[model samples]
Target chain A: MSGLILDFEKPIYELERQIDEMRNFAVTENIGALNEEIQRLEKKLARLRENIYADLTRWQRVQIARHPDRPHTLDYIAGMMTDFVELHGDRAFGDDKAMVAGMAKLDGMPVMVIGHQKGSDTKENLMRNFGMAGPEGYRKALRIVKLAEKFEMPVLAFIDTPGAYPGAGAEERGQADAIARVIYEMGRLTVPIIVTVIGEGGSGGALGIGVGDRVLMMENAWYTTITPEACSTILWKDQEKAAARKTDCAEALRLTAADLLELGVIDGIVEEPLGGAHHDFSAANQALKTAISESFAEITSTPIDTLILERIDKFSNMGVYDVVPADPV
Target chain B: MSWFKKPNSGPKKGDGDRRNIPEGLWIKCDKCDAILFKEDLDRGFRVCSKCGFHFKIGHQKYLSILLDEGSFEERETELRTTDPLQFKEKQNYPDHIKNYQKRSGLTEAVITGKGAIDGRLVSVAIHDPSFIAGSMGSVVGEKIARAIRRSIELRCPLIIISTAGGARMQEGILSLMQMAKTAIWLTRLSEAKLPYISLLTNPTMAGVMASYASLGDFTLAEPGAMIGFTGPRVIEQTIRATLPEGFQTAEFFYERGFVDQVIPRPELKETISRILSYFPDQSMSPESAEEGV
Candidate 1:
């Protein structure tokens, strides 16, 4: 009720609330007929929600990716991982809470899981800085990535953030150096890495952990250098007017999961349920698991030296281009 | 022309030097409208304390502030332009060049040199916005390429403080060629594993910001510096709208993830030194190294 609830989530939340109320009524009154009616209503609601979400615009998808009810990095770990032993501070400074990372078991195979997690509630959001990491968070992620390499474990990063924090303290803590170190280290890492953008993959905050052997994005997620609001504000000084032009902003920012896939910015997109992940998180989690498995299978089977070289080549070729004459001779 | 009888005592004896001086020697701060002594203004890194207006810095002053004292050796010093295009519109290319030379006393927009910042050797190239608005042309590209090569050969970092108004139109395709040329050198520098730091100064735009400036291992900018591929004015014109507050400013880019850091001028030296420390110290004296224990 307090934080932003994406447009699509309102109807889903309402339907869920109704279902809960009906189940409580049936338990209290011993009304078996009411239970049957509730089941039929739930099925009808699910179909309606699916139809509405199936034709979402890029902007609508961006909103869903940032839905407050959606899963964060910690939620994913809680659901899918076993034996998650979180590593602590960056050694240079204090620990960063924005990034949750550690060694964990993915179906009994040891791997490192790291990601930006925006807290669901106000107090936790303050602690996490709304998932925007400072220099320390990136350094922590880098530390675990290096450790993952040493232990011959694959690294899986779940990206979700608007961008790195741009506060004075972040700058003082060598934010740029931390990010550069990660980029350099990730490029040379001998172990396999599979990165997925589960939500808003905004700029360097995303890039700080986004580079890997394979980069995947959720079907409804968005990844871009800047958010639509920021882009709109930049192109038009009127913030209020910009807020009203969300569709144009979305088009200009090229933040859709499909756009990123076409631009070669991401390797693949994991499908989400018709309405959204919030409506069917289990299905979304399964899709993510399958995507990670396929990526790991392809990367882990490659020779270590060759894998490292390929990783280097992968980053080196990013944004590389040759401009030919549009009109041929 | 009433000759001085001690300036004819326009004020009382205890009026404390209240003389209405002529306004030619004073310049107003663009941000705060505070009039300051031109000389004192120059000493404050051209930034006004009251409103923090970043006055245009010349190529020499930029070098003096960035490079270690007495460590700069100028490169391409004798290379002067002869107006290869001989182009003219509202102003002739040769005439504009001559006017800039007379006003700024520089042969080209950029000055390339080898210098030490805190005793760590680096090849420093600075673009002077005063020189034809720091437009990138054939000479700017050539200077940057030479500096990159020198840095790679010497195994030192390459630091470029860029303040450009995009590629020069007079050079036409040649100006665009600079983007590819500089990018190639930057890629080579990357391959060599040498650090290439691009310091975006006020108003880095178009071809410059899109190419080598954006390709830094750690891209940094001065506070309030504007760095973008297209100017806000052009973008606004294309979109038929007004741009955002602080659009293209260093802070905006920092938030948008285009910049690594937005440092103030006073802290720049210390920050750069700290970053240099991440690399192995390469400052051992030649004599001491030769007589190894």
Candidate 2:
């Protein structure tokens, strides 16, 4: 499972595999020349890694974002925070396993941490609904954020869902209504909120719990209203054609973290490790921790009412349009 | 009612049957295959007299139907889309905007303004389904946000008639953020204790439904409107099964406790006026207040 290499990473993996084989051969056979060869190959591997990562296309970054080995929300909390207390249930219906929320401490300061939890394997994926939350999942998130507000704790939310689940049960239970209320409530919550997109920030599902005073995205994460595959399908109006044209759709959508930053949709981009966050978990956690700490400190210093109004203002000024003259009314 | 009622024996509703009806004088009900005079359909507010299905109407028609005569003074008419994402598929996003504007005779999907309902001053925004299925892009979102601000300024109740497929994906994430933008402004309205009434017309689904449309203080829906997060076809594709009859309809939402009331078109004006009467009219002039009473 650790050996899974994406199409773009194949060249780098091949060099890595060759270096490992040469090291083992030199150790067993006591060949001195093979050691020099191994050193040369290691240097080549470093350059290759840098080159590939430096110029990754949006689609390649998307693959890296969804990489199974990439750290999940729980992994970040465990890696960065101290004492953790896991909360559960929306208090209205059955608990949603897809959304995980709890009270936790960050650098000795109390904070509420919430995120969409995707599984590491097939069995766990089904259990987590592939992190596509249902209505109860959002309601659970809403319940905890309110708790965070009452206690006057800052919120750190990690977005990793593909979207709110589109299914019979979700719609029957008022999925849209649930998601809407979350956005509406988050708009006015008293505490400072800092949202970080660690993985796929899917559409309304991501935005359901995404409104914050400081919205940040991981370097490789992609946040868009819809997935490229779905975009292609609707644009081309044919399944097979859509399959072939999704890369173009991804390019056109401009969903990368850097793209969003340039478009002024996010406050900043949290840098990932060299080969992406999946390559070095500790480094990724440290970077995310530093970014969150800075953002939290800045917003917490401001008065609650000013912060809330500014939060609303931040979202209000997101789009670009012209105010042309109109026909007389 | 029997367990199995026989299917109605009538001309099946399809493309061929629709073409058979004369264009100007006669029209066909989409739900039931009842052929009727166009004049009668207009008189009934474009609802099927037999099956009670609400046919999609333009924003101007809604403004006329719901507001007092000549009282609707449109606002935010200057807001226009600029294709911020530079999106293109078979055609460019700007081209699509131009085409729809020409065909629908409107600048955007939603039209916002201040108007009077039963002589009580109120802010109003209505969606035109003819323009891109009333998909909300940046322009639509900003206009709605400004409309909410206008209500706060005027100290009047706000009414929005929504008929949208969802957020406009052509503008990408910018369109998605509009959901948050409008919803956030609505919180200001809520803080002021002003009333917000959202009416869902036919085919209000996805992003628009999940935002301001669902956040209304009082939510009402046209009869038989398709109202949900996901469309029936998409749900069927995901679950790999047939949907039960009347799934995701306005009536279905009402039964599921999502919608406050399922109103028919003809009674819309009277019902809305009655609902508005329940709230205190703070800015009503003496003459208008007497008329309101």
Residue A136 of candidate 2: its Cα lDDT? 95
The residue-by-residue lDDT of candidate 1 on B55-115, one tens digit each, is: 5576777777777888777765654555443444235667877777766667778888777
Error of 1 at A155 (Å): 1.3
Q: What TM-score do all the candidates reach, one by one?
A: 0.60, 0.94
| Residues B226-267 of candidate 2: C-alpha lDDT, one tens digit per residue | 999988888999899999999999999999898899998778
**Number of the top TM-score candidate:** 2
Question: What local lDDT does model 1 show for residue B199?
Answer: 92
lDDT of each: 0.72, 0.87
Query: Per-prediction DockQ, in order?
Result: 0.05, 0.66
Task: Return the DockQ of model 2.
Answer: 0.66
Each model: TM-score of chain B?
A: 0.85, 0.89
Worst 10 residues of 2 chain A by lDDT: A320-329
